[model samples]
Structure formats: C-alpha cells, structure tokens
Target: MLTAAIGTWKLVTGRADKLFAGASEERLYTELAPGKNRLIYLWGHLTAVHDRMLPLLGLGPRLHPELDAIFLTAPDKTVAELPSTADLTSAWAGVNAALLAGFDSLTPAQWLERHADVSPEDFAREPHRNRLAILLNRTNHTSFHLGQAVLAPK
Candidate 1:
C-alpha cells in the first residue's frame, strides 16, 4: 500500500510538472473561469501546501513558509506581489525534491506513525491520521488542482 501510494503520488506530480512546463507565463495568469483561481495561483497553492507537508510529516521545516499567506490562506488575486513564475517554479521543484528525499528515508512503519498536526490523544483514538494518510490527502488535493488548472483559458 505504501509503495502504491508513493508511486501514485510520483505519477500525479510528474503530470503536474509536464503541465506547468507546457503553460506559458501569460496563460498561467488567466483564470480557469469567471471568479475562479488562475493557473499560476493553483501552482503556487500546490507548492505552498506541499511545503507544509514537510513539517506535518516530521520531514523538515517548511521551505517556503511565506507562501502560506499568499497562496495557502488568502484567496486568489487578493494578495498582490506574488512570487515570480520563475521563483515559484523553482520552489515547486525544491519542495518536491525535499519531500522525495524525506519519503525515501521513512520506513513503512514510520509512515504509519501519527503526523505532527493531529494531537496524540486524538491520534491514539483515530489511528488513521498518519503520515501516509496526509500524503494520500495531499496527493488527491494536487490532482484536483491539476484538473482545474488544465481548464484554464488559453
């Protein structure tokens, strides 16, 4: 199950890399629909969320905590001065690289251990709130954004 989950995550993120590579900088700014998030916003949002997974999984500190306010907490276009496409692209790569390394370091038993966010007591009762569960959730979240991002107007 761990192997399958990690493989699925890599497959989805690989598709995301291809999608982002194909999109032009200007096109990334265009919204998927009226009042919807832009492709660039989705990209940054994924990067930000994935960065948070580091600490949550006890992998390491967040590499881009600043992105939380811009991409995680705030709505799209609400915050001005978003990071440049080049910078965000770099961050996306960096975060994923770190996550890959961390994931590789963990044993299957470690993956089953409780993550950082859930309280020990709650986790004791709901043993499903583990690092692997968080990874699965984030993987699904990334896929959802990737689907939406693909619909962004030309």
Candidate 2:
C-alpha cells in the first residue's frame, strides 16, 4: 500500500507539473474548451481537494477552507468566483508539501487505517476504502483533470 501510494503521488505530480508549465496567469480565466471549466478553476479545485486531504489524513486543517465552496463540487463559476492564481498556487504548494510530510511519517499500519469520516464498523466492512486507497483515488482524480489542463493552450 505504501509503494502504491508513493507511486501514484509521483504520477500525479508529474502530470500536474507538465500541465502547469507555460500556464499563463492571465489566461487562467479562459475556458480550456468550449463549455468546460476555466484553467484556473481546475487548478483551484485540485488544490482545494488536496488541502482537504490534510484533515482527512490527520495531518492538519485545510489551508484554504474558503475554497471548499467552489472547489469541492463540480465547476460553477456562476455560483462562486475563485481566488487569484497566485493564491491558489501558494495553497497548492503548501498543501502538497504538508501532505508529503504527513504521508512520510505514517507507518504501513497507519496507511491501512480508516480515514477521517469512516467508522470502524464501516472500515471493517469496506477494506478497500482505507487512507491509502483515498490517496490513490485522489491521485487519479488529479491526473484526470491534468488531462483537461493541457487543453489550456488550445
């Protein structure tokens, strides 16, 4: 589980770095495609989700709880405006750095432990829903959006 978690994080960061490269702070508000989310929104959403994981993994509180409203769910620019690109970028770096530190501190047994909201009974019933699994799922989620992020230049 530890190996899988580390490997998935590596994959996620690689895709994210490539996507963010050459990204323009000015062009972030532009839609990647015709009707999809703006490039900035995707970056903020991923940052918010990863920040929330801090609490879920018992690392610390979310660095930007304000982002949860617009980021936790699907993209909805009409509902709420996102923060500036610089702010989101800082939060993204801080959250990810903290996550890596926390993950490194966890023993293999802790990786198998249930995450924040899952009760013992529920965890026993659903062994696949452990903290390691959540990391893998979120990594895949980041990669999926990274695919959309690459469309910013088009």
Candidate 3:
C-alpha cells in the first residue's frame, strides 16, 4: 500500500513539475480563473505544503518554513510581495527531492506509524492518522491543483 501510495504521489508531482518547468515565467502569472489562484500561486502553495510534510512525517524540518505566510496562510493576490517564479520553482524541486529521499529511507512500518502532529492517545484511537495517510491526502491535493494548473498553458 505504501509503495502504491508513493508511486501515485510521484506521478502527480511529476506532472506538476513538468508543467511548471515548461511554463515561461510570464505565462505563470495568468490566473486559473478570472479571480482564482494564479499558476504561480499554485506552485508556491504546493511547495509550501510539501515542505511542511517533511516535519509532519518526522522526515526532517521544513526547507522553507517562510513560505507558509505567503503561500499557505494568505490567499492568492492577498500578499503584496511574493517570491519569483524561478525561486519557487527551485524550492519546489528542492522540497520534493528532500521528501523523496526521506520517503525512501522509511520502512513500510514507519509509514504506518503516527505522524508528528497526532498525539499518542489520539493516534491510538485513530490509527488512520498515520504517516501514509498524509502522503495520500497530499497526493490528492497535488492532483487537484495540477488539474487546475494545466489550464494555464492553454
């Protein structure tokens, strides 16, 4: 199950990375909708969310905690200053590379262990809140955003 989950995550994130890699910096500024998140925002948002998963999974500390305020906490276009697409692009690669390494190091038993945020008591009661669950949820999240992101280059 863990293998399958990680494979699916790799598939979706690879699609997202390819889309961003092929996109021109100017092209990423276009919004998915008239007032919805721009492709740039989605890139940073996904990077931020994945970076956080490092710590949540006890893989390691976040490579870019600062991204939370701009991409995670605040909505699109709300923050006056945002990182350059190039920077976020680099960060996206870095975070995912780190996560892949961490994921590779963990055993299937480790994946079934509780994530960092869940209390021992809670984890005992809610075994579903394991590390593998985070990967599944984030995989779906990335796939959802990737579906929207594909509209940008069109």
- Root-mean-square deviation per candidate: 0.9, 1.9, 1.1
- Reference-based lDDT, residue 21, model 2: 38
Model 2 TM-score, all chains together: 0.89
Best by lDDT: 1
Per-candidate TM-score against the hidden true structure: 0.97, 0.89, 0.96
Candidate 1 lDDT, tens digit per residue, 65-102? 99999998999999989999889989999999999999
Candidate 2, position 143, lDDT? 83
Which candidate leads in TM-score? 1
Q: In order, how many clashes per candidate?
A: 0, 0, 0
lDDT of 3 by residue, 10-92 (tens): 99999999997678878788888788889888998999999999999999888999999999899999999899777887899
List clashing residue pairs in candidate 2: none
Residue 115 in model 3: shift from native, Å?
0.3
Alpha-carbon lDDT, every model:
0.92, 0.80, 0.91
**lDDT-superior candidate, 1 or 3:** 1
